[model samples]
Target: MPLALYLLALAVFAMGTSEFMLAGLVPDIASDLDVSVGTAGALTSAYAIGMIVGAPLVAAFARNWPTRTSLLSFILAFAAAHAVGALTPDFPVLFATRVVAALANAGFLAVTLTTAATLVSPDRKGRALAVLLSGTTTATVAGVPGGAVFGTLFGWRATFWTVAALCLPAALGVLKGISAGLVQEHAADGPASHTELATDGPALRTELAQLARPRLILVMLLGALVNAATFAGFTFLAPVVTDAAGLGELWVPVALVLFGVGAFTGVTVAGRLSDRHPGPVIAVAGPLLLIGWPALALLAAEPVALLTLVFVQGALSFALGSTLITRVLYEAAGAPTMAGSYATTALNMGAAVGPLLAATTLGTAAGTLGPLWSSGLLIAAALLIALPLRTTISTGRGIEVPR
Candidate 1:
């Protein structure tokens, strides 16, 4: 709702574009660098690894700095990394640059999410998070496709240059929109303010201990499982549509566009509902995915049915996603920055694992249908884990911890 929050979303858009654009340019990168496509694909893995390892580390290192300062610093570094990536001559250099870029992206995301939560009232945290995350969904719909087109026309390096250029505006937005004094005010008003913990050793330790609670741990696991379930089917969506659903190759892009539209819609709906009823929203999201997947496997042979199911699946997954992030913040209401970093790490882990699981399934007799069924069972397990926790839906002052 605040100008600062939208600025943070803009920053996320730049980062999300850089993160996903590589998926579209892998073939070009492999050929340019004189490596196998598999090796170039490892660049994606390298970036995910950096995100998982870098988020908490950066959050800890920047714990003492003002939120605005950390965010700007990270984005500057992210922009610089892309510049280097565009100029790199060899695969090794490009791979290392990818890691650096990912670290910067992870740091930026952790600080931005915490800052966004602080900018809004407690009841609006879920909606705020959805607004920030919309950047990623938008990237999938627009930026990735744009990058692919740019890479095809110019060169892969040109796409990286464009990503670098995008970050400049985001950096300027953070500089102009967020101020040191505003950061202090928002932190003071927030449910979990890191400003006080940054200087107090004992308070920081207590905050870390709160994050280690069994309830919080369960929520993190659920976050990982939910993402894994979503990605499992998504990683091989093209094959599923073509082979399993008996659709033409031409239909793959159409299906993806439909899914992206559904995702945007889902985030919008979830943001509004989560502000009032996060617990109930989360409870339904997983089960809906559970039901949707099996139905997809059964009905995918029909084009209209397949397209309808894909859209629904996208909507359900993203709706669950926003709530999962909100749930983590509620559980770790005393350490929002650390909680956000942990949530990012958990989600990245799932993103890496899901594709592997799907690939293995595709190798089996079950083929493409394996991902749909597997994802359903995984969501079912996640729902069972999540249903028992008592989440703080809303509080007048901030999210309240259950005693």
Candidate 2:
């Protein structure tokens, strides 16, 4: 691994911490802003919306920029947004900062995906993605709980400052990466610069047309459904631990840490298997999530049961989620320039939509338990939707190279 890879991972850790930490901070933000919890929860969706919009737009333009320059620009923009977020007292201003931070994060993530893949041999693409995404998984383990703890000790604003400060070190690392001569310009026409196995070009029309393929659309929807299930349940977990399970505020970070630990483990295992055994991994985890999500809903009131199920569900969620994302890359083998953005958009769209649906369940008879039930339904829908997309995943090695 290059020093640049580790630097890129740091970039992900900084942004991902902010993204997942909102789950724990929503209650704090709501209380501080004098808004309903559901209303404050919209911050997560705002971030997701930014990511969804940023993916395609930035991808379209940044596709031709130097790899180092693009990464540096996005990282600096992200830091600036988080700085604004940390200082803002107004809810709307804070909300706007989250969206801006997400847009910068989205552009960085999309470009990183393609950039990381090119660092490895063709057969190791899955592992490259996994390595890049590991930053996200690691952020879940450390940064999410750390953010929650910071929010508890100081304020939600303190956590934003912490994330912004992280970017300083990451920015320095990116400069060092440039000095190492590791990441050069990404020239679509100069050489075989893109990830696709087939011939690639700089044609914008060729890239846009791939977004319309019926098969690609199905895969994107499948990714969206899985994320919908994840965020729907995950966005409300602080409440589930405290309000539903009758735990103290202290337990919130503990609960998040357990889920984070599980996610870290899940993504690590999925990374190794996704390259050669994606079909089997997906086949097994999908059914398990179906059963596990509902079980979490039924046992939401039992502290031990809820905690145990949170770990299990986190593991299942990311393991399956990572595989599906890798599948998107495979299915998008023809859309070299657009593939990363497409994958980013698919997952972010689900992230944007899920919490909105979960917000509807907050005050119902289901109470705090509604989020998990919604998640369960989303998983069922995801499985049904994957039927068509799964046909393309091979049972053998190379995860069935796209024809």
Instruction: Give Cα-based local distance difference scores for all models.
Output: 0.78, 0.80
Write model 2 residue lDDT over 77-120, tens digit each, in one string: 99999898778778899888888888899898887776665565
- TM-scores across all candidates? 0.92, 0.87
Please identify model 1 stretches exceeding 4 Å from their true place.
181-203, 390-403
Whole-structure CA lDDT of model 1: 0.78
Structural RMSD, model 2: 4.2
Error of 2 at 41 (Å): 4.9
**After superposition, candidate 2 runs with Cα above 4 Å error:** 24-42, 88-93, 178-200, 394-403
Residue range 1-403, candidate 1, lDDT tens digits: 8776777787787788788788779999999989999999999999989999998888878866777688889998988888998998889999999999999988888777777766676667778888998887777677777787899899999999888888877888788777663442243335533233234333556667876687677778888888888888777788888998788877877777677777778888888877668666776777789899899888888889999999999889888877776777776777755767877877787877877777777778888888888888788888776666545322223364321
TM-score of 2: 0.87
RMSD of each: 3.2, 4.2
- In candidate 2 the C-alpha lDDT for residue 227 amounts to 85
Query: How many clashing pairs per prediction, in order?
Result: 0, 0
